[model samples]
Target chain A: MKRVLMRGNEAIAEAAIRSGLKCYFCYPITPQGELVEYMARELPKRGGVFLQAESEVAAINMVYGAAAAGVRTMTSSSSPGISLKQEGISYIAMARLPCVIVNMMRGGPGLGNIAPAQGDYFQATKGGGHGDYRLIVLAPSSVPEAAELVGLAFDLSDRYRVPAMILADGMIGQMMEPVALPEPVDPAEIPPRPWAVTGAKGRPKNVISSFDLEPEGLRRMNLVLQETYREIERNEVRWEEVETEDAELLLVAYGTMGRIAKTVVRLAREEGLPVGLLRPITLWPFPYGPIRALAERVKAVLTVELSAGQMWEDVRLAVEGRTETPFYGELGGVVPSPGRILEEVRRYVR
Target chain B: MSVELAIPRGYTRVFSRPAALSEAGFTYCPGCHHGIITRLVAEAIDELGILERTVGIAPVGCAVFLDRFFNCDFVQAAHGRACAVATGIKRARPDLVVFTYQGDGDLAAIGTAETVHAANRGENITVIFVNNGIYGMTGGEMAPTTLPGQRTVTTPRGREPRSHGYPLKISEMLAQLDGPAYITRQAVFDYPHIVKAKRAILKAFRNQLEGKGFSLVEILSTCPTNWRMSPVEAGRWVAEEVSRFYPLGDLKDTG
Candidate 1:
């Protein structure tokens, strides 16, 4: 019930620990380095295992191992490190292991910079690695939401036996905000992982693997995964709408850009532009239905991001030519101002 | 009295499959040493009475189906990340015995970094490394432990150090690390070498049971089908040729 000011990265770490994280493994990278440092200092105190892995690849594999061992596990990294973790992530997804992965975003195609960017939207929502798979992606626009969403990420991952991701950026990770942290979960009350490989004490030996060499066998396994994804899509679509009741134009964004668009909406409304904002919280089970329905009434929908219009394609898919869809993005970690976003809105509104 | 009358009914069973190994038949090629090595490891588990508390990590090579062959709980790792995976399992459940069964390509080439770092961190786990000098599952491709002048599918005209680089001495390299409690390279070509290799596998597993950190037993194995030789001729090659480059014996023992 007590609100305490904490940095966004550290708040996420605290939330994970409270959510009964058994093991934390990661390699250091920019913007998210504080999260690792926080875990290194706090996780051991809570009787949890903390390891600074050799590389991002090793870190994700460690998560896979711990998750298979029937424990809540996690790994954090920035842009470059997340790319290195793709192989393990793919294996984890196919293996149907439950784990949390946090990517505090940074600019990149290569090693762009340590600054904030939303360049990984495509990678996070789409298949970043090989094979047919999807991650339950959550994007938090503020430190408080970031902390709260960490718990939801763990829960949804465990509920569906799927990997979940917290996609945030440097601005949220570096900034400080007041947050009332979630209560620490009782480890005994955590959901039982009947399928985990726990030494087969009194039961049949459990074997955790994602490989099925036979054509028919592999097809069956993939179909099961697709069914689970459909279930998630049916139930887990989440978003936030503001000032949308009678607005003529809609603004779509997420994470850092989404929070900025909130201000842009207010600024545009004050100038009688009649703008509303739709912020997607779940990036993969994206708010397509909401966007599509809003597009039916709005004159135009504009997407703003920190990248060169990566999430814009998804907006267009949701709109489906119901209305005009325009994209405005700033590349290379540029944080566009509210006034700048309002100017883009003015172009679309009239 | 007859010899059979002096012993109990069950006492006559001297050479049966270890209880730790399942009834599932191994999928390895004929004359491959994986069968022997897996049996040896299972034998160690049975002898140590830890089958109920042991977790095996299957690598992403020919032994990728290692989970099917073991009665104990098993988790399959991504290519070359067995050591890291084993480390995670062991650290998460320290009460459970964890070990990785990895081939040369899965341990020394693509996974070299994970292998080295796991050893360096002194993660309390056993590593059963099988070095056959070529990528057997991937059709006799050149491996990190492939010997110079050895001809694999990738090296059609024999491995040239100028182009392919030198064979990696993983045991020798890992032995230098202070974290390892045991590091040994043994072969399984014939009776004597097979006996020694079995002993090495037991020793490595025992180290994990005793809470010793990072023990690796590199067993020089055979790949007859990939080597384009008969089973008998491949065993001879392991004895006469492969043993020369990867000489058998203990490189380090912190015990």
Candidate 2:
């Protein structure tokens, strides 16, 4: 009912609970520890299952287990921790289990640092694990958006029977924001999971397996997964277009980078420069169509990210020579300021 | 060819295939022991009358096909992650009886983190660990439980302590942990050992049924084809050399 002033990580946890999360299995990692702490305290009180798993690998498998049993499950981790979870994530993807994963990204090629960075764009959007699969990646630009996306993640995961990841950076994970929490969903209102491995009671047994040893069987399963993904690409693309109606210069970003780029757009416009921002809310089923159409009008597009221009490739594909596409980004845990981003925009335009 | 067996009219069958075990054709190599273990698990599930509330977690290796034989619900876990998956299911639906069937490589090597932690947390679940001392699914390779001097495809020159490291006794190691209610290592090579193994399995299942904490039955099985032995030789090897290295009987029974 009332808006609660909470940290981004805390809000994400609370929002997930309201979305009827019945089980949570997570290991503590930097920039996302508060979310685990919140669940540890609240889930038990609410008569739900909460377990601090031994490692990120264990946590994801636990999510796999709970989801197989027809329960709403979630897990959270940061960059390196997320890497440890790739094996389990691939299984979850292959099994087509519906679970929510929150990746509050920190810097990394390894255990890089514990500061905010959008370094996981490629890892999140592109299949991070070894498989022919893709996670439903949602990039939330602000703390409120991050909270909202957490709920959307569970909904989408169930709707598509896929793992949906909320891609937030450390800034969004740690910063405090006033968010109006949604009303809790009644678990009874949720539809039954007929495929879950509850038991072979009065019906046929359900087996949640990824092993299809036959060549034809594996091919058939992959085809089914690819079709679902194609449908997601068609209907689930989301984005925010800010002042792009008639702008000659465009800034493309997502997650916290999108928020910083917006400020850059305002600063450039104040100096009579033609600039606007296009913040993609969904990064995997990336908004390629909108970017291609917008590229027709803009003179040039500048892609901004917290990594060394990982999302730049996607922007380039979307532009497809319609406009001159260039990129600028900070490395490791560095967050580019509005001034620095504006300077990059001036360099691109001039 | 003509001796008629005496007919006992009052004789009723004491055992048939358990109701929870389906009549699926087992694909295990002749005398692989996976069939026996699966049968024992099915018998335990039926004896406890938890078939309607039981969920089995299958491992990544040979037992990955456990779903085909178990009439109850089953979930196939990633390589070496059966224990963790079972923990999740048991925790979420506390009323269900969840168990994992894992092999040497899956339980002791790649999935050590999951296995150790799930047991350390005292998760209310059962784990049936099949230790044949080699990785059978990937074509005979050195496993973490492979005995010293044991040769396989990976260790063609025999397992050298310096190069291959030492075999890990995970059952003994896990038994020392404070969290587990029952932890034992038994064999199914002979009828007497098979009987003891079944009793241990039934007890572990009963422990989980009574809400007792972590329980695991590490069955010292034989991989006949992988060992390059006749099925008969494999059983003899399991009794002599394997039994000498990994002693039989319960290592821990806190219950």
Candidate 3:
């Protein structure tokens, strides 16, 4: 019921605290340090644990420990930092524990710069770490959505017992926006976890491990995980179909790019052109069905990204040859202006 | 008269599986010293009566099987991250006793930062380190703790200090730190050594139980399979050779 103007990083941190985040551990990286700073200042007052770990690797593993102890846990990092945390993230996935990871992404391919970029779309959607595993990834276009998704990330992580990532970019993390914060969910509303390692008091020992020596056992575990993934895909595909009815042109985007595409659509429409937009919210389960069905009606689809065609591949696959798919992007954190996106749209429509 | 009044106290069961050591059978290489050290830690936990409230973090090396062996609530960490995980568990719930069982590769090599920082912060937790001088699970690779001139799969020509650098004396190094409440290096080769190692382990655990902060016991263990020797010969080597590079005793003890 409270309305406030907050930065995306601050919104995420405050929302996590409200969501009953019992432990927050991370190292500071640009674009996302506000989240860590906020958590460090606030979590202690809430009787929660806050630690600035030695490294990204250590931070993720700390989340693993606290999550295993049956508490809400999280960590935030940038591109390079996230790269360092891949091993721990993989282990957390293998261990099947619920935790939230925020990647306020910066330009990369190797320390590209501390600026906005969507280069990590592949890393977030696809498996960044080793093995057959998936992280639930949500991309938010606004500060309010960023705050809302933090709560959703925790709920989805707890519901599925999997790690959920809030894939925000540098622009969203640093930009200020007006937002009405959601009411914090009560801890009692969270699903019960009998499997957490609290203590062995009168109960059989609980072993949380990713080590399965036998191939049969390991393969069976992957299959079970895949089954859960299938359930997630079936139930959790979220997207926005903006004015798609009777549109001759379709533009696909997400995160900061999604906002830019919205302006491009309005510009194209004002110029007497029929253009629409499809914005994906969940990056992993990529709203593929919606994109495919939309492609069936639209004349052509073009994907706009802040990186050199990272999420474009998924866009191509989702369209499935129903129409020609073109891509527009700027690498090294050079975000395209709406005018530039409108030009790309004009090439395909009217 | 003493025997007549007390019904022979020795007749009572003196030794059994500690409540911390679970019913699961440990599957380690024959003669590997990890099993012995695992039991010592469990025995320490049992003797202190902290088994009900203790949380054990297992490593990713040969000792990863600790998750199965230790009966208390356990979480398995990625290679070399056990100390960081234990730090998290302890900080979140100080009421819960937390400890980590780590191998040389996991502790001194890959996880050196986590190990050192956790210690430097004076975290109230226990660490059980097994320095076998080789990476046993990965089939005898060179470890950070491998002795000088020691032969391993990665160092077929023997460890050359010029290229490979000298073996890391992690225990000695950690002993110099100001954060540790207790630091010791013990061996588990013979009966007397085993007794001393168990005692050191108990001391480390007791220190944490009293909230002393950052106690570690580095047990100079042996990997007979990796060393290409019989279990008996491995025990002898730990006594004759391993003890030279990693001496036995309390390198540093606060209490």
Q: What is each candidate's fraction of native interface contacts (fnat)?
A: 0.84, 0.88, 0.80
lDDT of 3 by residue, B125-193 (tens): 999999999999889999998888889999999999899988999878888899988889999998999
DockQ of 1: 0.82
Q: What's model 2's lDDT at A31?
A: 88
TM-score winner, 1 or 2: 1
- How does chain A of candidate 1 score by TM-score against the true chain A? 0.99
Q: Which lDDT tens digits does candidate 3 get at residues A1-350?
A: 66899989999999999999989999988989888888889889987999999999999989888888888999999999999989988888988999999999998899789889999988888989998889999999999999999999999999998899999888899899998887877989988878888888888877788889899999988887898899899989888878789788888999999998988888888998899999999998889889999899888988889888988899999998999899888989888899988878888888
Extract clashing residue pairs from model 3.
none
Error of 1 at A16 (Å): 0.6
Better of 2 and 3 by DockQ: 2
| Best lDDT among the predictions, by candidate number | 1
TM-score of candidate 3 to 2 decimals? 0.96
**lDDT preference between candidates 1 and 2, better one:** 1
TM-score of chain A of each: 0.99, 0.98, 0.99
Candidate 3 — which residues are off by over 4 angstroms? Answer: B1-12
Q: Answer with 1 or 3, whichever has the higher TM-score.
A: 1
Q: What pairs collide in candidate 2? A: none
**TM-score of decoy 2:** 0.97
Q: Residue A47 in model 2: shift from native, Å?
A: 1.7
Query: How far in Å is the alpha carbon of B108 misplaced in model 1?
Result: 0.7
